[model samples]
Target chain A: MSFPKRIIKEAERIVSDPVPGIIAKPHEDNLRFFDVIIDGPEGSPFEGGHFKLELFLPEEYPMMAPKVRFLTKVYHPNIDKVGRICLDVLKNNWSPALQIRTVLLSIQSLLESPNPDDPLANDVAEAWKEDSSKAIATAKEWTNKYAK
Target chain B: MDSDISTGFTTDQSFDAFEDDGYDDLDTNSVVSVVAEEPLSYEVPYTSLSHEQLKQRFVSSVNQIQNLCGLSHEVAELLLIHNKFNIEWLGERYLDNPARTLQSIGLDLKYADYSFAPRLLPAPPNFLCAICCDDATYPVTFALPCGHRYCASCFKTYLRMRVSEGDIRLNCCLNSECRFPITDSVYKLLLSPSDYNRYRDQLIKLYVNCLPYLKWCIYPDCTYAVECKVNQADLDHIIPTVECNDGHKFCFGCSNEEHAPCICRLFAKWNKKCADDSETANWINVHTKGCPKCQATIEKNGGCNHMLCRKCGHEWCWVCSGPWSEHGTAYYNCSRYDEKSGQEARDQQAKSKASLERYLHYYNRYANHLESARLDKKLYLRTQKKMTDLQNSTSMTWIEVQYLANASDVLQHCRRTLMWTYAFAFYLERNNNTHIFENNQQDLELAVEKLSEMFERNTSELATKRLELLDMTSYVSTRRSLLLKDTQLGLLEGRWKYNLSN
Candidate 1:
């Protein structure tokens, strides 16, 4: 029924001193649930777009990684159509020391550099591998059409 | 009296005979000497270690590494685990350059000055545990050489979580960039007693799995591991059947049941073929014919020779598979026996049918022996009861009635060996050596069946037929070893040729 001090403190810190291009605000009813917005990094194909994501701290949070998924549609090889991001820190590489702020920063960096080789979307990865410029062009088009 | 009964049931003398006949090209005296000393020729030499015995081995290896490398116990354990308990490899690398090996395994010699053991110290003023964000909860804190300190409670939780996840390799610092390993002492200091025990069990499993020579018995709740020096490359020639401490026999090569006379490769292939739909495809190939025009598979069910393709509406004669118009006068019958095209089609059909029949021939024998072996196991259980009844009814003691139990064991063992011979024969190409192998197989099967039939007699008759049963038991066991010896020698000499591509 009650959240841990770590989750409460993390929630307080992320809101009070937010990352430059990110905003994470916990819901009033449930302190463990947060509505997140990450601004696309400059110089990336996803630039100038605001991607919405949802973060939920599981019962084993801090011991386990928080479950996060994108609410907005994004065109990236690593991000699947259903908004699952294939990032190492979100899975096996997650350390208990990593907080919500660090996880968000990792996601933002992931958007800046989409890894096609270890992609969650197979077709998108294949297209990215075959033609990079066209893949970036399509990514930009989707960002404007959907992420706006 | 006990020694008399034991000698009467022993197959050692016959095994020596097999050794002489099976390996005549080798030094027969030495081969006979070994078989006469130990009648375990068919089984690979292995030592089964219990949990405590394995732990003792682990401790001794850690001590050896520690004394050799002049490192502390915890650090030596870390090195051993990182090198997968390979003492020789670790020794070579450490002797070549200690610092490099240490750094490569993330032990960094620079941190060698810090104690690898976890120590409880008072937390610094206003210390914030980065892990749990708890600034004031715990008075004591723990930190590795990396100085990424966290509260003791938080450390306990993290280590417990990692241990429960079966991760014995714990990083020293929680900082993702730092790769220094947390020593076993730290896990012991932080984890609860039960969690620490679980961690040690997992570590032992990791050790057993890492070494190529050791494998845990695959049976459920089996804590024993068999140490065998059999080479992986020799698995094609040697079956490497080893028994655990609990008497569960299994092949050390693939961890499957003891499948002697059948190499692991062919056994696996046979299993996959039986499990897959390849046999179903064979069935379709035997029974179904494709339409000439549309290629739809057609199975004739009480139809005349003149056929019509349901999909393409093309008329054809089923017998010759030629156009119906060509069979103008021969309405229901086909007379195109010598036509080249028709003959080719017929040959293809006959080839598939033959192939299917060939597979079924071996498969039926294999399945029958497997079922019979299982039933023989049940009969052995009943023989134990029969042994007691014979002891009560006759003047014989328990040791004297042991012949029935021994006979049942030989029957089961021979039936198992007989089962795998069929699978072995299926892959064998036709050659003179194969004929010899088949003859050996027939001898073993016949001996086993006779012994099994004699074993089924009433307990009252069993006491009178004790000598007969013991003789048959010894004979059946000798027949099994002879077949195994011949197959083993044949595998080593490359005398047997296999149709492996099939």
Candidate 2:
């Protein structure tokens, strides 16, 4: 039940030099599990809201991508109801060189620019495509009601 | 007593192979005379390549590209794979703009220097491998032209994973921002011996898949490939059935079983129709009856002789389908014969029943031949034992008793062709040419049945009937080829019309 040197080093780096608007704290028992929080970017609809997410490093670690999901609900086309985020780097585009910090950064940018074209939630994507302003308004409402 | 009869016969010069070889052998004067009198227009020319032969083809193609482009072997391989092994296209593109073509596949023109031969270099003091987050000064590290340095062990693990995932073209650096391509030398240095072989096999598989003229045999565990220059447009007139080195016969066009006299289009349509109709047809036959007046399909869950159409509200008897009023006082014992209402009801039912009956008509014939062919395959296995028994009991040698085996082979082949003809005829529109096609079908079927009956006789009678069996075998094979030739000509000449509405 000991972690690899790479995982320990990555954990130390994320704690010492954290990315802006992001906070990641590992669990007391399992160094592979972390509780994360990301403040929404300034100009996006989710601005001023803090979103909670859970991240777990699988056994394959650097060879495979880490699993991350939102603990709080958000009304984005790419983020589904069960908190699965449809980001390319988290799936096929993932490379071993990519770290946990970079993945969080990609999620933050996804919030800044909600791509409705490659959406995971079909209804939200349809709504977003039909009326952009209304979709943004609904996203803001969900951010206030759920993400807080 | 040989349990390996199927494999044994396949490896020998069976009747199917005789037909495949266009009857080149003149040893059997009787069989040769039967087939050689006719022109062999139904045979498609193709070549089968074993696994080693395929590898040699791949290596020679790579060498050709290397010699033409004056590029390194690794670069030439990557270029050929990227362009789908089209040497002419690669040559044209490379001659037009070498730098652009190289850049298109993520190969920098300056890659000749350090990228081709990936070597371990001492890491800079205080260097950190970002992938594994190792801050210690690693003794040796690997870096591509992109300068994204990582420890050698990490590089090996990454390359092994990608290779196992069947990725032949790998990126030089793990960093997403760097789009440099990894060379074959890098893979050779990084991957284990087993994984490296897997990578090479995957490369050849990709090469085969990308080329339209080359197709791997569809049989399971088959390591052979067939090369045919048959055009895709010719599939309508030609059923490009090619046999692999393992004697597995399959159509090169759709990679299905060898379905001659049935073009790929109608065969595909028939296969789909059968897949959709088989279960429904069986269910309708068992549980449902159409309402006589309105023809709405009604499943009688629980009811008496009194039936009501839910849609049209037509009242009739469930037993005789006569008007319930006509059943007056009979109370389900109504025995009305040829009554006006009953006749009208039966006529209405017949009108609705015709199409289903038509489909069942063709489907029943197609399925019967398929079943008979399967049973004949079992009989073929038994024929091996019968051959051995005949050899022991009679004064025949091992070669003399092969006529029974040949007859069995012809029976199976003809039955398969007969099965597909039914599927082909089901789509054919009624015309003068269709009548001719049906006549040809009848002749082949009659000949096949005769040969099949002779093949199933007891082992003691087999030795006495050898000459007759051989003659029938040759006759049945000739009939099948004639049918195929007529159908092939009919397709090419556009003489056969199709009823595609259904």
Candidate 3:
């Protein structure tokens, strides 16, 4: 089947004007699939680290949001092990106007300010809630160990 | 005689003559209580509306809203749909703040003016579609009121996906920030004719699903909707058994087959309970008897009267569970009645046994009647043919034999009432009022069995027995009303004094 033109345009635009600290490049074999890297936001526990993620545009692209998962492990309450993030824009908040560029930026900012209140990982959130400095120390340790 | 024989032959109803069925063990005289109250009467207030009637009512209501609100039919429908199709609620909301109510449902009336141009103008030359970013020629792009243009192909794909998602509301501009909703007129001009039909169907389904009084007909493969015009306030006190135009009967309140006497709440609770653990309860009741020693339930396989409780290791006769030496298998007499077992021990045994007996009694009757009702329904077709035969063979018109149909209907009603009464009795505690209720139940049971026996007779006998069938049907109907009325009273007035543990 012919690829949807909107996806091709979004892919082209992502390559033309790359967002700072975020790199997204579509796969050579499948333009709908992309490999992305996000630089950790400064001063965050994840700072000085790089996180790899994968994004796939389903056949219902633009109408349905793309499926994204983190390939590199990170310590955060909202992002579960196996890298499933619980961000609203990735789900019901998504709209056809949202493109690869805007989505990656949202994920990058999500790393900087993690909301432990509505978290996907209970143990991580509980640890963060119990002691923030201690939890951030563990996050920093994990970032250096796995997300390097 | 051949036709009469054929009627009985074709009918699969395994009903037997009342005298032949050896149920005379039921003590009729003792069961009928001496209660001389006024005759009971109940009106199952319901009707079946034709498909055309349902449509006419909806169309008129839509038109009324359109004229009152000075909005298009689709917008009025959307407003009503958002408000759960409660037109009164819609009117009150509209009266309070019209624009806010419309805006809340994603409609901006100002955009309606943009749709005045009857036709969509094609895209300008060298125009780039915002969605696809395609350098498309004129006639290949469609634009909404917000001036957000996308290639026609892209717009169609987006609309198709959204429609399939089952939210048939109007589509908004593709741009995330644009709040302008596309008008139905614009959609019709852009979409292909077949897609347009699907879009309208989805819209109609959305309308029907949200409407407070409209429900899709429960009949399989039927697309019609059943509309009930009863006052919403009265709906709580009444169970409207609506028969859709396609001959599907369902309770308006619960969308289940008509369950009279059992209110929708109780009916739902009973269904959930039955679906949960009824089969297991039935198996235990049928196959197991409690160990006389430890009170643990025990199932007996191949064994004589002499037995031993596996848990307690107490040796006793299975029949009376007395001392092992008391059993004499000489003639299969297990044991003699022992007065030595203290009254306290005997009383506890009697109490538990009585509870089990009560449950088994209700459950068995309930299951039996349900099975009978199923068989009777199968008999209806054969009875119809038999009625025709009787009409042909005797000096009777089609109308004269139509009593057979009425008899079948009355029988079904009695069966359903009897089935639910068991569920009612299951929850009820034994009280003075329960005596009268049980008497009423017995009366209905007798009448149902008699009518069923008559129904199973040969056509010649049935023709000759029309008067008996009619009389039995009326008796069944009256007794049913009494049981249902008394059950309802017991439920409302708290006469049963429900034993929560039971």
Cα deviation of B45, candidate 1, in Å: 2.2
Stretches of candidate 1 exceeding 4 Å from the true structure: A126-130, B1-36, B39-42, B110-117, B122-124, B134-139, B145-147, B175-180, B301-304, B308-315, B328-333
Arrange candidates by TM-score, descending: 1, 2, 3
Tens-digit lDDT track of model 1 for B91-207: 899989999988876777765433565698888887888877765557889887678888888888888888887877645567777776888878888887888899999989998
- State which docking tier applies to candidate 1: medium
> What are the candidates' individual DockQ scores?
0.75, 0.74, 0.58
Error of model 3, residue B479, in angstroms: 2.9
In order, candidate lDDTs are 0.82, 0.81, 0.70
lDDT of 2 by residue, B1-502 (tens): 1111121112133453423343435334346245544335766777787767778888888788888878888788888888889999999998888889888877767653232667889887778887877666687899876778888888888888888777665455788677677778888888888898898899888878988999999999998788888999989888887777677888999999989889999899999988885547645744677787788888878757778888999987876776678777766466775667567655655654765677778889999999987797588779889978988998887656656666777787788899999999998998899999999999999988887778767887777877787788788887887898899888889898999865
| Model 3 regions lying over 4 Å from their true place | A74-82, A115-145, B1-74, B86-99, B102-118, B136-138, B211-214, B224-240, B278-354, B486-496
lDDT of 2 at B447: 87
Q: How far is B143's C-alpha from truth in model 1 (Å)?
A: 3.3
* Residue pairs in candidate 3 whose N, alpha carbon or C atoms collide under 3 angstroms: none
Which structure among the candidates has the greatest lDDT?
1
Model 2: per-residue Cα lDDT at residue A22? 97
